[model samples]
Target: MSNVVNFLTAGVFGGTTLLALKSGVGCGLSGLRRRETLFLAFVYALTALIIGAIAGSIPVNATEQVVGLGVVMHLIIGLALVYFGIRTKKAWLSDRKDISRRTFLLMSLPCPACLAATFLSCLVFTSTTGVSGVAAGGVIGGVFFAGIAGGGAATSWITRKAGMDNPSTLGNVMLFLGLFYLLCLLLVPAYLQAQDAPAFGIATDPSGMLLALVLMTALIVFGALADRIRHTAERGGR
Candidate 1:
């Protein structure tokens, strides 16, 4: 029962609500079977959880190293994901042959935000159950697979019913959610670190502050310019 409780609380519910919404929109956007795509994602996520849990058991501060790596790459990954959203809305189908794959990757692959949640879940489960990392990982990862996949399926169904199963809608959600993630990646990590809080393993220093300020400025400029360009193009014929 403790394992079950840990699975539900730690693994199933560990991910952010925003991430759940992102997964739903991504599933809709992929035009693939949500279960199948998310299954693949679950496989990837489970593998990572197992490996991460085992690594965490080592005497060294593996959490710091692992989460540090994630923090380092999140900005780049966030930018790329936002681009994916934009391109899907504007680009031809030929350019999006791998939308399903990308969606699955978003759901599972090296996502910094999700990675943070995952390791935490693993730690909680293992600690509570006094089980080996491998045992805890399997329990947590299995429940995560079921919960996320189930939620994604339901969300896709709802969106379909609402007539939102289109690239434009998917792209819009992706764009907004991706940007939100960027903001979190940019600011939340350092703030959490400074407070000695959980969530991220980012360094709390002036460099992080400088990076955030610079990148935020760049994002604002690019967003304004792109919005202007898009609006102008829409008004091109008028």
Candidate 2:
């Protein structure tokens, strides 16, 4: 595929990642004024462009080295996230703080999945076409900006309309996203390696797919439960 297409695909997937989705959902619930959310969304999208440009500068041969280093860096971040998740589960379960600017920061961090998409896009672009690094980076940045910003805008609107805004929602999103990231980076990768498969393997393998399904189901359930709890509290107050 062409670099542009690769970037578009990666950008879409990157925006839909658990981290990105949480960023969107959390932003909607963050209690920021609509204008603030808009500004943050734009800034976050700009971050994608910067990251893409940096990623584009690396020679294609360092793919393996980059992947290894990425995994290590992600592991450390994943662990930190998991620790915070555990620490805050109780508050989230009970009082639930509503405002969180942290989601934006967390989402801004280059998670393993997002990095994978970036490198993969770079690889494709470099091999298939002769675009300059700057050109390729611009394309990647533009596409990613569109995906992230568009998704954020949609979520922010839906949240305002549906009244799903909650103080704790953003923190809760961070916890869930961290759990998902840890699961993918720590557990799934080891298992995939043991099975003589590639990391991030989500092909026709029923086992892999089933596990992913379970994880996704958990996220869905968590969102539903949180919303229900908020509604219940509202009714109780009434």
Q: For residues 182-228, what per-residue lDDT tens digits would candidate 1 score against the true structure?
A: 77765776677778876555566778768876886798688768877
Residue 59 CA error for candidate 2 (Å)? 3.3
Whole-model Cα lDDT of every candidate shown, in order: 0.61, 0.57
Per-residue alpha-carbon lDDT of candidate 2 for residues 124-219, written as tens digits (9 for 90 to 100)? 554456665455556655555555455567776876687755544455555666667666664666576668776445335558766876985687
Error of 2 at 183 (Å): 1.5
Off by over 4 Å in 2: 1-22, 44-57, 83-99, 108-120, 190-238
Clashes of each: 0, 3
